[model samples]
Target: MKDQGLSYRLTAGLEGYLDPADALVTALAHGGGADNERCLKRVTAHLKADVKEVSAFLGLVRIRELPRREDIELRNTAFLHELGPSLTGAEITGLYTELVRRTREAMQGRLGPRWAEQLAVHDLPTKLLRKRIGPSTVADLQQRLLRPDHVLLTDVSQRLSGVETALVRKLRRGAATDDVIQEAQMVRAHADIHRMKQQSLGTWPADPAIEADLDERLLLVARRTIRSHATDPRPANAIFDGLQTTLETSAATHDRWPLYARDSVLLMGRACAISDECRFDWGTAHESPA
Candidate 1:
């Protein structure tokens, strides 16, 4: 059930920023090569992102690019709010210290304390470990999605395997030539369109023709988005930047260690192992569950 819940969230998050069919196509289109790098390159998020922008933004690349010129103060305040609602100073320090110490020890033979300290300056928790992930995260994600240079190389690695699987399915079923074309069209149509990013258009899709046009637009939108990020990736980059971002500041003030997470979450219905002796010891000590 927890797996299903995570799966459900994943599906929702994908739809929120990705074009499903186009992503599949991109995955199919870019998954394989003589070299076999990543699903796509540019959109991939290599650092501390909850959503991997590199291979993931593949389907939504076709949207119109609107320049964002927001007021600096308002934008800064919002960013802080979004990222500030999790973790505490001390806990952040603890995690950072542990991560750095472990990393240094692991690499001591190769790089020594000097290089390790340099690396430690950037060590922080990955996106998955954070207590808060929201619009600020999304905004950062959008940066990678839009830029050819901002990709996370490692994020696309996992998708290569999936692409192989998807390609087989498509080829086996004899899927049509128009299918990829249709998907591409969808990607281009809305690859960059956003309701929130608008300058306020009233009743924008004003005609029946436009309504139908929107439906037809889906495939192109998929193409534009996917193609931009169409590079296979490495897997370790997201955590790297995520950890580094934390060094700039502590975890959000609201950050609390969750009871469950991908790496450390305790699952539902795992039996607590309390032996009779332990129970008797606890009773003798007059200890209660804290």
Candidate 2:
């Protein structure tokens, strides 16, 4: 079931990237208005092709089917092949390295120091390893291994969300032709870790510690968004709506921690109030707060 869930999340993550990619491409193709639209169409087609290649690579990783290296020269050839023209060689290497680093970090966080050994024994390609480890041991190992994958999958999904958010922000800003073209070229570069950190906090894990953490993160994100977009009600409201939905969903799952839920709801209310005041000020004065 966990494997199935991972597969589903992987697909969802790819879809998350694709949906925004499509919107971005469409926006870019039309961003130049009718005069330059013909030229922009070629750019959009190239970006679409790039997205397809990246999607193929991500799909392979999703299924755990990435080809093993044959030699030092051929190392990461598959990744390079799939990401060509979209990313420089160094960028592709860095991206792969970041993925590996995140996977390791996830394992360490979930499995402690000896995660490599723990994962390796369970993932051994032979039935002999499992037989020797015994049924109970195998089951225990499998359960423990599931958590790292869950953490990794969640991280991937959150990064996709960040990309989508960035694209939406660009769209809301009435992205110029150059901005749209640059954005399309740098689609994978939009996964801001700082932004993702706040968004990632809303994931499930309904303990007191997690609840408190979520509350803090949500407030920080809301305050920052409100401050940055004080005069721009559209972007501020979009952010507020996303955060509100996240907080509400989180609050709903706090049957075991009603106080936490109450506090989160109150925090959200405070944010909304601040947003309302800012919007009112903007509307009345047509000026930003000093």
Candidate 3:
């Protein structure tokens, strides 16, 4: 069974490598004439190099596979210690930066206009750099990002929904005060509305009227939630004050709301958790809830 599992994994990995490899080879063949001996030699060299790298990577994987299950931390520590003498942090960072640059170049070369459209849609280059993914994986990822299917959209939507639902449930059950719950809900609503606006950007002929309505509704929720919790003496009231200040100071169309809303939610959540912890600690230490 273990051997079969390994076989399946190896086959899947090869399949991933093969598709891109085939496309690249075909591109080279088409770009260079079929009768070009130089192109043929280049293709042969490329394949051989790829095979050698894959074999070496697999060998390392197999060597690490058993020890990984036994004591991953110890194995990782030993591996890092071995590299400590030779591999400086600056070297690692330089290598990573070069990888990202090469990946960007490859995407720009292959994807062209589609790649530009993606950049206009989001800060994709920054995201790629942040992820620090390998150049070899970029082709597959670029295809998916450029042409996301219904399944991908549905999966992402479901995952986001799942996360929001879990957070709401926890906030309701765990919050020590109604004020905390209300403030958290306000932040959550803002985040949801911001996400909806971002999603609308992908749609052609987006209805500005509908978006305006959402914006108004979000503002109303924020104002109402803040008003209700204004007199509350909790530490989370500071979060509400910040939100109120932002609402008053910022222009209605400013792009700062999304980030502000996200930060507010996180801050409020942390404040609530700390407040609950403090109450618990006070109760336990002094036999009275603060």
Candidate 4:
């Protein structure tokens, strides 16, 4: 199992080098006599696309784009040569077939027929060096839980959802002063614009830690509202109303957010749900017969 795993890792690392090499080679093969220059130029452009696609795939698979060590390549070559011949031809073909499919899909709707022809790749010898390796179970799960592979996701989610809590706290301390209200308004406006920027940059799927923190904060705010305004239910009700409003607006705005920001919207939904549930529980407890 360990040897098989190492083989897979070696193949994954080799894939980046072989991807563009194979594209250029295939184009050269078709170049033949007359169209060599034109084919080379076309292949050059195709190579750029190939590099981009391959880089994205590598990132997705969490493999380094380029390894600095020289001996690694030699070792990989020796290992593959030693191991390649014994492997059945069918296994080799299946590997390349899957690679092509994955490459096209990773391009994310950009892989058209022209691109398919320009790359013009088929089963190559190096295809045996192409293997799909994924992170360990814990690492993979961690990645899925986090926000779009960014550390700032936690801060952003907190900042965005903090608006309502900030407002409630300000109101609870005393009457809703102009300065307090203005501060809350400013925070909300800033959060809205920040969200739009994140959407534009395709930074969807907020980190789970960030979302979890926001949910807890929102719930805390709801509980505080109940405690702080036991005599006047209006403020607590308003806080719940604000949570609902934010949730609805966030969902509607997601239609305009980038494809990558889909996870962020879900985070918003989860945060709102926590707030809503907290509010409902408070209301039910207050109304219970004594």
Candidate 5:
């Protein structure tokens, strides 16, 4: 039974890695030439790698399928000037496949595509993506940024919905805590953006102080999410579920004050005295859920 379960998980991972479109694009990418060699090399490398279980192998392949981009959301931010030429059908299909497959992974507690988008333009400075848009919207062009995986997903920006999850499974215990926190922040940001956009408020007070307060509170929650993965580690999906709950509650109490007020940040400043221990210690954080 354990063997069968492992096999099932492995196959699921492959489904994500070998998305039809990805395979198609890969095929076209080689144009029946060196690309084939590259694919073969990757497969050989995989075989030789010290992959313990089928799930590990499949997970690696899925990670490899993930698209790497400097700027996030090219279709939404910048798609006009010159980044790359038009994508062929194979290219388009490949991206779409990767995106959906990843989103599915996120659904299973990996953190999703929104996390990917967040990593692209978060407040943190890192080597992942380093292009700034000069305090302006790029609007789906390939100028300074490009859409991840070339998918037409201008709807929700939760790109890391599949992989932002903080987990020991993803790495050993020595992984950078800051990186996990940043990824969680990205997930929270996407959720907040979706809520704000759905409401379509023209001006909701973009005060730096207010935004910073909100971001901090969300960051705490995001950190908690990462911590969850540290334990039994159902962190990503758990955080996402908790996010949905918070959003619904906030939307309901958005107009109220104190008891349920607009000025109240859900997890932000003055909301709860969430100290360092509260942020990371699930036991302490949950002890007083009043």
Candidate 6:
């Protein structure tokens, strides 16, 4: 569930920064074989910023970029929370030493000689095990790191995936002359069906369908905003950036992880699916009326 939850959060994070159809069209219009790369770059930048903010809220410091490893502060805090204040120095030290030995052996067995050897010297727990820090703190850290991958929960991934699949199918069935609004409505309808399927599976949350009818609305807004800006000579890039910023700013207002996580995943994932399906359609990219 945590894995799914994380996937959901990632989807939400993406929604904050991405305008699926706009991103796709802009990238293709760039005409340099940089469509995917360019679009992803923008998305990645936004995701990283959100991740950094989230990590900071969770008490991680000194992160220059999104880290793959658990922060020492997090590990220490979790450890202390799990183990009470009754630990003695000898008991803590003993536990740390044993854990280090076991961890090294496990790493060595799984990762081969070089990594095991590298970890033997460089691992945080290994180093901390030898330190004369407070016993309660070390003892606490010991227990916490033993368990891994704690996270919030959500079931948006599968739902989002279903929406994606249906979106692609819908787009592939579409005509070149199809209005963007019409396509948006079709995509939103398919997303609704997927939402119902998720609900039927009982994996979806009991929460209101915050995502319902949003695809049509986002597309409509995008069409209007982009068209409204068309009078500018450099309208294309401005429209794309403006729409993206608007979504990102709106998503950031979620303030809390769960709300942002579920809403974002739903918003971005469906938006992206629609965009991906229609990227080459060129019909989804509406020009300003002359």
Clashing residue pairs, backbone N/CA/C < 3 A, model 2: none
Task: Score residue 34 of candidate 3 by CA lDDT.
Answer: 27
Q: Candidate 4: misplaced stretches above 4 Å?
A: 1-174, 206-213, 229-290
What lDDT does each candidate get?
A: 0.29, 0.39, 0.39, 0.40, 0.37, 0.42
User: TM-score for model 5?
Assistant: 0.23
lDDT tens string, model 1, 167-243? Answer: 22221222224443233233223322322222133533445463244322322332333343223131112211222
Candidate 1 stretches with Cα past 4 Å from truth are 1-179, 182-184, 187-199, 204-290
Q: C-alpha displacement of 143 in model 1, angstroms?
A: 31
lDDT of 3 by residue, 66-93 (tens): 2212233323322222223244545434
Estimate candidate 2's alpha-carbon lDDT, on a 0 to 1 scale: 0.39
lDDT of 6: 0.42
Best by lDDT: 6
Q: Which wins on lDDT, candidate 4 or candidate 6?
A: 6
- What are the per-residue Cα lDDT tens digits for candidate 5 across 1-290? 55676442221111112223356444533332123545545654766754233223333332223322321332211222112226544454455455445545544543345767766564644322223332232343233235454544332234334332222112222232455445445443443443444334445554446545554555555565556544333333444445435645564333322222343343322222222212232221122134
Runs of candidate 6 with Cα error greater than 4 angstroms are 1-210, 233-235, 252-269, 277-290
User: For every model shown, what is its TM-score relative to the native structure?
Assistant: 0.15, 0.17, 0.20, 0.21, 0.23, 0.23
TM-score of 6: 0.23
| Candidate 5 lowest-lDDT run of ten | 9-18
Clashes per candidate, residues 3 or more apart or on different chains: 60, 0, 0, 6, 37, 4
**How far is 120's C-alpha from truth in model 2 (Å)?**
93
Alpha carbon lDDT at 133, candidate 1: 42
Model 1, position 197: C-alpha lDDT score:
21
The TM-score measured for candidate 1 stands at 0.15
Give per-residue CA lDDT, model 6, range 1-290, as digits (tens). Answer: 54676422221111111123454543333332233555445644756756434433223111122221323323332232224335554554466566566655544433334645655574545444433245563565545433454432233223333423323333333322234334444544454445545655686656555443454555665566656665554443445445545666665443132322435434443554444433222123344457
| lDDT by residue for model 2 (1-290), tens | 54676533232122112123444433333332222345335544756756444443333332122222332223332223232324455555665565455445544434446646766675653333322334454353334334432433343334443433322323333222444324332432232222223344664354658545544554566555445554553443345445556666655443233433344445454333333222111111123357
TM-score between model 3 and native: 0.20
